[model samples]
Every structure is written in C-alpha cells, then in structure tokens.
Target: MDKKINIYKDVEALSEGFTSLLKEELSKREIVNVSLSGGSTPKALFNYWVANCKESIDWNRIAFFWGDERCVRPTDEMSNFGMTKSLLFDKIPTIDKKKIHRIHGENESKEEVQWYTSIMDKYLPKENGLPVFDIMMLGMGDDGHTVSIFPHQIDLWNAEADCVTAQHPETGMERISLTGRLVNNSRNIVFLVTGKNKAEKVKQIIEEREKFADIYPAAKVNPVNGKLFWMLDEGAASLL
Candidate 1:
C-alpha cells in the first residue's frame, strides 16, 4: 500500500481539504465510483459540500455507494443511508437517481448483503476478478474498527463474500458491510478521522503496528495495488 498522512488544524480544515480532493478526483474521469462513510465528520463534509460546492460540482458524473449501513428503515436516525440522504442527496435534487446505489437496510441482513454484492459486481469496474471502486472512504471508531468489522469479529475482514452481514459488538444491530477484500481492492482508500478520543488507536495503528496488528480492524486497512490516505485532524494525529 502507498500511504500518505494529511493532518489538518481541525474538522473545518479537514473538510475543506477533502472537498478539494474530491473535486480533483471527479475531474479525472467521466464517471467516478465513490464509496461513502457515515459519521459526524462526514456530516461536516456534506454540509461543507452543500454550502460551498454544490453548484460547482458535476453531481451527475459521480455514482454514490455506502461502505456500510445499519439494518433499519431509510427514515431511521440510526440509518447511514438516512443521514447521507438528508445531508447530501436531499439537497442535490438534480443528481441522477439511478446513480445512487444504497444497501437497503430494511431488508434482512443476509438478503441485503447479497443484494449489495450483486450491485457492486454489476456497477464497479473489475480488476483481478474483484470489484474496484475509484475511491473508498472509511471511518475509524475509537475501538479501532473500520466499516462494520469490530475487533471481536475481525475475521470477517477476509470473508470470501465481497459484502457480508455484520453485527454491532454491543448493540447487536445487524449491518451490511463491504469485506476487507473489497475495500482493499479500491483504487484509492481514504480514512477520514477526527476527534481527540481517537488519538490512542491512531497512535497504535500508525506507530505501534507490530503490537497493534491482529487486534484492531482499522489497522488492517491496506489497499492492494492502490493508494491509502489518512485525512486526520490535529486531535486524531496528536499522538503521531
């Protein structure tokens, strides 16, 4: 994996930098397939995009997908699709509806997993017999998990299926997540992380790799034949 670390002053600066990267990337191709992450920081990014770049961006040229989504109705507050829909999609009414491919959280976990897997296989470009997204965005939990692969269920990272059914460690809520193999196959994988609470795990993943391996799922995000980027704020990069 070719990796780069970008530390910003705060979430505000991080969002701005991410917006620039997104624009530069979208300009590189006619249709860019980007997998999204759900979280407060991403919420910030959406708001920034809406407030600053909505009119400037060529929304139709991008296809949107999610990295993971909780098993809940699209209207549910816990739903990743719901949050993204409200924050981004709702504001961009002209965006082509056919380009928005979401994992239906309302369906059964196993069923939705198969549904999303087929969607990826149909839409994403393939290389080495695996789906290859143009860009994959991920978030890191304080517990060092990325996507829905919690530390306790780390083996799911290598599940043969490109997408799998996952359960939250404590809540036990069902979720659909792209397995590590799928995420690692992307052309560009970026981790957008912030907050002081994540400093320890960030330190462990970046500086104490030998001791941290096999423990944190976030530490396992290595892009095969691709580039990896860490877009962090000062708080998350403090320990580094």
Candidate 2:
C-alpha cells in the first residue's frame, strides 16, 4: 500500500484540500464510486463540495455510498445519509437517485448489512470477489477508531463479509459498517481527521506505527493494491 500525509493549517484548509482531491479523482474517470464518512470533519468537506463543486462537476457520473451509519431513521440528525443529503446531495438536482446507495439505518442492523452488501455487489466495481470503491473517505475518532470499528471490536477488521454489523464500544448503539477488508480493496482511501484531542492517537498511529499499528483500528486502514492518504489539520497532526 502507498501512503501519503497532508497536514493543513485548519479545518477550512483541510476541506479545500479534500475538495481539490475529489475533483481530481472525479476527472480521472467517466464514473466514480465514492464512500463517504459521517463526522464533523467530513461535514465541512461536504459543504465545500456542495457550494463550489456541485455546479461544476458531473453529479450524474458519481455514485455515493457511506462507510458507516448510525442505526437511526434517515430523518434523524445523527443519520449519515441525512447529513450528506442535506449538505451535499439534496442541493444537487442533477445527481441521480439511483446512484446513491444508502444503508437502511432504521431497519434491523443485520438485515441492513445484508441488503447493503447486495447493493454494493450490484453497483460497485467488483474485483477479486470484492467491491472496489474508487474513493473511500474516512474519519478517525479520538479513540483511534474509524468507520464504526472500535479498538475493542477488532474482529470486524478482518471479517470475511463485505459489510457487517457494528456496535459502539461504549454506547453499544448498533451500526452497519463496511468491513475493513472491503475498505482496503478500494482504489483510494482518504482519512480526514481534525481536533487537538486526537493528536496523541494520530501520532501513535502515524509515527509510531510499529508499536501501535496493531492496536488502533484506524492504523489498520492499509489499502490493498491502492493508495492511502491521511489529510489532517494542524491540531490532529500536532503530535506527529
């Protein structure tokens, strides 16, 4: 796996960087499959894309998916699909509804996983018996977790399924998340992380890889036959 690190002065800079990267990726092919993450970091980036790139890009050629989502109604504020729709999707009238593949967060978690896995199999590009996303946008939690995979629930990192049910380590709220193997199969995996509170964990994951690499779930995001990019703001990259 090839890895790259990009540190920005702040969230605004990070958002701009992500937008530029997204545009570049979109221009590379006629159609692109992108998996988005839910978090404040990506929310800002989504807003940037909506305000700037919505009119410029060919939305019809892009397919949207989520890396993970809370088990709540799509109308709920905590819903990843809800946030993305409001911040990005809903604003773009040209985007195709058929291209938006969202997990039924309000449904039973296990069933939702199976349903989403089938959707991925049908829509996403397949390679080596796994769906290969063109781009997978991710965010890191303060606890070194990413895409609903927590430190305590490391088994999900190597799950054979393309998608699986996950639970928050503390709250135990159910979630549907793409398995780590599936995420690693993507063409590009970009992690957008911010906040000073995550500095130490980010440092341990990026700098002290040999030591904490096996412990932090975020550190396990090594894309197979793809590129991995870590886009961090000054706060998150402080300890690095």
Question: Model 1 off-target regions past 4 Å?
Answer: none
Q: Work out how many backbone clashes candidate 2 has.
A: 0
Task: Please give the lDDT score at residue 223 for candidate 2.
Answer: 80
Positional deviation of residue 64's Cα in model 2 after best superposition, in angstroms: 0.3
Alpha-carbon error at 139 in model 2, in Å?
0.5
Per-residue lDDT, model 1, residue 168, is 94
Show the lowest summed lDDT stretch of 10 residues, model 1.
204-213
Q: Candidate 1 on 1-240: residue-level lDDT in tens?
A: 598899999888998887777788887888989999888999999888888887888999889999999999999999988998999999987678899999999998888888899999999889879999988999999999999899999999989999988899999988889999988998889899999999999988977765776999889888889899899999999989
Error of 2 at 94 (Å): 1.8
The regions of model 2 sitting more than 4 angstroms off are none
